[model samples]
Each structure stands twice: as C-alpha cells, then as structure tokens.
Target: EADIYQTPRYLVIGTGKKITLECSQTMGHDKMYWYQQDPGMELHLIHYSYGVNSTEKGDLSSESTVSRIRTEHFPLTLESARPSHTSQYLCASTGLAQETQYFGPGTRLLVL
Candidate 1:
C-alpha cells in the first residue's frame, strides 16, 4: 500500500461547522503538504511544513489550519467551514520539492 492515507474520501457538510481532514503516512518523511484542487485541474499549495513544529502558510488563501506533531502525521482543521471552502484536499509528502511527492486519494468536500 501507499505510505499516505486520507480519510472520508468524500464529505458533504453543512455551512458554519468545524471539520478536520486527517492525513497520515507510514514513511518517515519530514516534509508534508496540503493542497487544494478543483475538479480536473492542477493543485494549489494551501499549507506546508518542513519538519516537526515548523509549519508555514502557502501562497494561497485557505480557511483551514494544519498541525504537524509527529513525523508521520499532519492533520488540517477548518474552524468554521463555508460553501466557499468546498474543494478537494490533497495531502502529499516528499524528501524534496524537486523529487516526486506521494499523494493521498484526497478528500472531496462539499458544503451547502
């Protein structure tokens, strides 16, 4: 199996609620990232971390926040979600940016 995993492959949430997207990896990768993607399109960086306790915001705007505690786990949380927050969340990791990043199947979220 792939090293990465994301739960709730699909989620339909109501407006103004809290949600957390789980991401974990078996591989001992120190780098982890969270990206937002629209259907049939490219991915946009939303959040990233180089190592433990080193988290940085991406160039894009997201209502979500991420935390990295263990080397193999990173989870994103949305304090209050809206319809505008609906998008596919892809979790990825790599030893380096130039190297290939392994991605999770993604969590497709829709808010109405």
Candidate 2:
C-alpha cells in the first residue's frame, strides 16, 4: 500500500485563523508535493520539494508554507487562513519526477 497520510480529513474554521495541515509518508520517497483541490474537482500544485533541504514553490503561490527536513515528513502550515483558502490539500510523492505518484486521502479545509 502507499505509505502516505493526512490528518483531520475535514476542517471547518472561521476566517483569519492559523491552521496546519499534516502530511506524512512512510515510503521514504524524496520527492513530495502539495496540491490544492476544490471539492470533487481538479487539483492545482501549490508546493513541492526535491529532497531534504531543497524546497520550492509550485505554480500557485499560496498563503501556505511547507517544510522538508526528514525523508518521510512534509507538513503544510497557514499562518492566517482565510475563506479563500478553503480547499482540499493533497499530498503526493514519487521516486522520480517521471514516476507515478502515491497520494494521501487529503485534508479538506473549509474556512468560514
């Protein structure tokens, strides 16, 4: 099975609150990615990292930030979340850019 996980599954919070969406993987893959997706819709890449100490922002410049210190952990944090930040955050990993990615269930954030 794919060794990835996301917590809360669902979140409902008022606007202008701090939130952190947890993402973890046990597969030890070096390439991790974060994507924002609307409910029952397509996904938009928001963050990605090549490996430890190497992180980069995705096509979407998000209010959220991510970190990669260990091989199997990458968590995203939003300093102050807003209603516009409401979306599902999906975590994925691949052995290589050309390889197939393993995705987690995702965290659904609903900023009120």
User: Residue 52 of model 1: what lDDT?
Assistant: 92
The 0-to-1 C-alpha lDDT of every candidate, in the order given, reads: 0.91, 0.90
lDDT for each residue of candidate 2 in 66-101, tens digit (9 for 90 to 100)? 999897889899999899998989999988645899
* TM-scores of all candidate predictions against the true structure: 0.94, 0.94
**Candidate with best lDDT:** 1
Q: How many pairs of residues collide in each model? A: 0, 0
Off by more than 4 A, model 2: none
Among residues 3 or more apart in sequence or in different chains, the pairs in candidate 1 whose N, CA or C atoms overlap within 3 Å are none
